[model samples]
Target: MTSAAPHQSILDKPFVLDLFAGPGGLDVAGHSLDIPSLGIEWDRSACLTRYAAGLDTLHADVSAVRRDAFESLPPEINVLAGGPPCQTYSVAGKGAGRKALEEVKAYIERLMAGDSDETIDRDLKKLSDPRTAMVLEPLRYAIQATRSHNRQKRPYDVIVLEQVPAVEALWHHYAKVLETTGLPDGTKYEVVVDVLDTETYGVPQTRSRAVLIARRQGLGQPFLPEPTHLAYEAKDWNRRAERATSGVHQPTLDAEASAPEAAGPPKTDGVVLKPWKSMGEVLAAPVGTHPGRRTPFLVRSNYGSSGIPGRRGVRTDQQPAATVTGRISRFVVFEHLDERVVREGARFSMNEAGMLQSFPPDYPWSGTAQAQQVGNAVPPVFGAHLLSAALGLPTPDPEDLRKPWQPATVEHRAKLRSHGCGAGDACTARCPRPEDQAPARSSAVPRKKASVR
Candidate 1:
């Protein structure tokens, strides 16, 4: 596996264009690896936050790109990536997408069958939730890139996407369509789809996403990133967390566990693969803080199967976090075994919440509904691993994520700020994000199943 292109020099880095990019999670990861990337997001708050973090961004609806609103896109961009909205398809929420699953698959078949955009749009208008149709949006770009008629005679070298696990079946359909598609030059794509656990890739959350990567054929076989951190059984995590909540010291992993990976054994490019990271790792008091002053606490989630204002779920600081959703404000913390403390900063700060998603501690989060952006982001740590694996490049050392966002080969984000929005009058136009005009407090997340594993 290598980053060298088939026809280009070994030193040329591929450029990336990400669609529906929420707060630049993948962009952060791309920048960390020194790969140039630009994210197109419609949400004003998310775009503002991305700008504050010095990430390159286009604050516009992805649909606009379809209408040729962006004509100056660089021809050098050979990688297309995005994670479209998944609320309609999410099992944890309304079943509009789930109920229309077969309809969605039929749409993919129709799309690949050369159905016109007008035809697809006309039929899509019949769906209960308009967002359900957005699931097929990524394919529009992918298919166009492969066409010889487009100005760019060459196809994108790689295409990547991710969404909630409920979208796994849809991604499989994508893989099938992509592999079978061929351009006049006999160029086709090879695709792979997998349900990836964020924790397995060293993310502090247990979120799972259905990811698809389609590499233009003849660019070597594509593969998913090997898991670095071992998976922890939910029961074990709960038991260990119980002990920690009761004042017992809970180590990262079981010291006496028989499993080699559980023991933090070395593997994967000879780097020592470690146990899954815990909330304590990111949530622990800063280095200069007095250790004795930081007391033990557990996060209590107010939203769950028991319903809001009913039975809540709790996770200890010693364990990885339960999935952090867009409604992150629902999770609160209390004194260990006491619910009434209401301590200062007990509710996670924006930085703490972002860190839980493997974002840099100082990743400048700006604008309204910042929590929604953090919750919606793909953890940058895991994003780097996925991109590295798909691009046939070296997977980075996960241990190095602890320090401030500095990586040995990474350039400062300030150098890329030129791609951000223009100032003054030029930025006057509000991004066309009609769907994002909702009250920040009313943000919704797909209902997730209790993560026992």
Candidate 2:
């Protein structure tokens, strides 16, 4: 975790409301920055999860929530944030039924108006022009309702919505809604379809999401945070940095070399760093071992699992583990030992999996099964970076939270050899029938600690 700098002041921090706040990742980001927030989620488990994180949670469905509820909240809310259910729009679920699409439209409308159950149901049944027609219903209702109330305050000073890239189509309708609601043109709202990886901000996983930030007329366009750590590169193999005690080197390149190549070198004249975190780093220990009793799985099939591992599995000391999913899979890939007790498998723990997605270690999740809850959450770290940018705050640097790895000491190597492999060349040799002796250990290692300032 990065040390908290003395920021401008508490009063300057914005208040936030997180809609469709599954497991509270968005709320977690708000709270971490001392931004008071209210989270609304319909799922009982999700509500409990947010509550566990010390957030004010409303268990009512966003579609059913009345406009008065929003009006009841403090008028100081500067940011309205949420990652509405994406399952209906995700490419994986490609066939986004009209019903599902309408639901999304309704939710947006409600967000705009405050919901009026009587009018919503009647209009939704007859609504056409699926795109605008669906969303405009709630928006129109809300506008009229707010106008009728003659409330002195606007619903929210800023609105942030996150979803898959496909959400751009909905923006046109949302923009129209803004116009109808008296928001002036050139209102300084931005819809970013391409997003940088969250891992670039220090969370171990690489997750790309689309973010939209809309502010009331006066605020400027939200600033996107700059990349902090460069992607790991082969050229950086020899680079070293100074540290408080001994020097530390960056982790050797793993499977991340296959990361989608960038168009060109970054403008920042330093070695490019990888944007995705390795499963090895994220999965520090075996599954079901952490205090939360979460378990990690190997994705063998799309949506099934072989159950969690027990014993007798390959070690993952060198190879990158399987892609972590938000759902269970056919295979079980936890840290386990083979018949020879060789711990050589590519797997991760649930905690590490969440970290890869940039969620804080303590973010709460509640569900009947561990996989269901963890898989359904957004990484809070990613949300924080996104929200920080939306609020025009400087983005947090990924290196600021990265835990530098210490090279294996001589004793550690000896321990590895004792486990089974040969002595001299066994420990350092790369896979694929090792030929040459491992490279000599460097006395002058690069320093790993650098601040963002």
Candidate 3:
């Protein structure tokens, strides 16, 4: 938990190359921690967003970028960080895991050779699917391609891989590859896998991601950040329960509650289980009075379950929001309306959704459709925490960061408490029904009945 000095400046700091950088969330966090960074992204709008954030961005596919290009740069890059595309490994997508590997393999081959001509194109095209292989394959190649440099006494100090929990299995291969290289097995690299929620890091949302931290030789073991904010159930105060019982509050239950009684919580805490950020905190005013000023279809869908039109219907003063997702279908959907009020005819806007993900208010996203950009972003606050930890900087003060973006009301705890439940008592409201609780009747009258017969 190293803290940065007040006079410290990120300008001219150690360099980082952000691969597959989306909307520059990682870059933003890195810069906040005083780490200088550049990004490589294929999406035009994402490039614009990065540029607006004052980041040096390359508008090209990461796989197409060669190691020489990086080698040629004046500054020495200390780290390589990015979350490669996860569609192949995502459960929502067809499980084309192996195909995804080939795609990365082809990209790595081209990058290593510094060639992206017909041969590379042909190889890339040969892969019919990209969902079967581990999403980190390209990263593996990037590291190996750069390994020769390590032998020359210069190597990347760290590589951070962010992805869905499903990608954890891929780290073994990455570890093995790092070992094979001449870098000392334990000294050269280490892998850290853990669940991180944006809320804990002071983001308004409760998005949890599986973060993998791998450090090159000579650097200290990459830090796994401590939880800054606990989930509703795990919070020190019973704030979650208070809000839930209050008429003014409506908390989004985790996705597990949707399952049948017998089915247990998902083995992996799916993103749905995380708390949610409110819509009002995130949405911006419509661009103009005209219909064109209204929000897009997908952005409106984020609030569908609340039965409130236009507004995300989030109650402020609650825990941060759940993890933001790309598809509206994953969570309950909301209706679109024109006004900001949670009225019948109001609509939801894309800007609001982006705020929930903790992107800066001024982030420049130049896409016609807002959902695509919003879906691709990682919450900037979450990224900032990780970046700070990695650089051995101090954690941001909780008060200085955004408070949990949940709906809140000023009600006494006693007013919200259940009638039969006490401070230490188990919840009786969820207990078995009265009839089920009755003891079974005994059958000791058999002899008397026989005599009577």
Candidate 4:
């Protein structure tokens, strides 16, 4: 697939705009590939963390921003990636899918009609649902950008969006909207949407997200990412963890017995993929502090004395972790010490949660907000694979994993101070840098580029 337009070489690299950017998860993935990335976040704490990481950020609510605001961007935006706030669509949340879809459509129509703020605010307040319609904001930007710029000079080349699985239907609706509605030149978009599991991308967590990739007509066909890691199975785990985690009846192994029969693997992308990374292998330390042979924890949300139906708790060290949610504080961890297991209370720290999400260990995290951000973030490792697919770059080297955890660098802190921001002002309004022009893609990436099948 090749570009349909002619002209500048500046658009060679993707210029990423991560809306609803949380703690720079997607941006970090983009940065690792040497792609110039900018984030738009409304949360003060998230913006603080982004700035501390030396990332370019704009602390503004995405719903309030106008499409014209992006006109100042340097390189033509090749990729517009975002994971809108997903509370309303998440299973852990209200699961208000039908209502959310309707509201979003209505909101978009109102916006297109140039509805007054007072009228919009009245309607929004009456619904009392701030997050449901938030998903439409990105589509609004996409529609406007494509309309303003002709096909030969499109504003954006690719659109990448992610959300909880429950939003898949909405995404399908969105794809229809983009496909049926042609641009000013009667050009339609090529769209693909599917749900992807994080573990399949080698992340240590079993988080699944709905992904959408849309290419403006003539930018080649839209492609979906394929799994780079092995699917999780009971037999493909460390012995101790396997015995502790697997729910299927596992045959006891004699010390001298031959290995169990291995299942034939499925082929994808014409490559033999590596096994999924387990929580035990990633942590290296025992998980689940409660007394038992288990070393990993099966955490759930809002499971208290209420006796929820889907509240079966299990333990293991062999498999990937359950989806990391905002209520990570409620996850209990047990420790195995000596010959006995002890109640370690909440076993995971913010850093641990971030690590499970494939964030660098030394990634600077701040306070309670850090936990929420980490839990909601798209794992950077998974992000790397998707962004690489978008850029037609080869998959990232498995050896190039998350960086070791460490405190913020003096240079990072100094840059924060230069903007008059400090540790104390992590939740305050601070200065914002002007429009960022990303540098050329670094040569660190592998030279072998491949397209998705």
List runs of model 3 lying over 4 Å from the truth.
Answer: 1-12, 92-95, 98-126, 130-153, 179-187, 233-319, 327-342, 345-348, 397-453
Worst 10 residues of 2 by lDDT: 444-453
Model 1 poorest ten-residue lDDT run? 2-11
Q: For residues 362-417, what per-residue lDDT tens digits would candidate 1 score against the true structure?
A: 66777787888888888889888878877876766655555555322123333333
The candidate scoring highest on TM-score is 1
Candidate 4 lDDT over residue span 1-453, tens digit each:
222232222247678888888788898888777888877876666766776677777666675554335554444666788987655554344546566667776765565455654576567766655666568767666655655433334656778888777778778877776677544334467888887777778888666678888877776666666677765543233343335436432222222221223466555656656667765566664333212223434333333322324433333444566566665556665543211244453557776777778877657675345667777777888888777666556666544545563444667645654442333344333333323311111101100110000
lDDT at 261, model 3: 29
TM-score of each: 0.82, 0.60, 0.60, 0.74
Clash pairs, candidate 1, are: 92-447
**CA lDDT of each prediction against the hidden true structure:** 0.68, 0.45, 0.47, 0.60
User: How does model 4 score by TM-score?
Assistant: 0.74
Please give the lDDT score for candidate 4.
Answer: 0.60
Off by over 4 Å in 2: 1-11, 90-120, 126-151, 172-196, 229-265, 268-275, 285-325, 328-331, 334-350, 397-453
What's the lDDT for residue 227 in model 2? 54
Rank ordering of all candidates by TM-score, starting from the highest: 1, 4, 3, 2
Off by over 4 Å in 4: 1-11, 72-75, 90-96, 106-126, 146-153, 183-187, 233-261, 285-312, 337-346, 405-453
- Would you list the clashing residue pairs of candidate 4? 287-295, 288-334, 289-333, 289-334, 289-335, 290-334, 296-316, 361-405, 362-405, 362-406
**lDDT tens string, model 3, 1-453?**
222233222223557777767777787666555567777665655554554455666655454454334444434676667776665554334546644544564454343444534564555455554323225334543444454453343556667777655555555445544544433222346556665555655566545566776666456556565555434322222234335546333332322331222254322223223233334333423322212222321132233223444444232222333445554223332334222445443333454455666665435555443456676676677777766666555664433223222211223212212211222222343322334321211100111110100
Q: What is the lDDT of candidate 1?
A: 0.68
TM-score of 2: 0.60
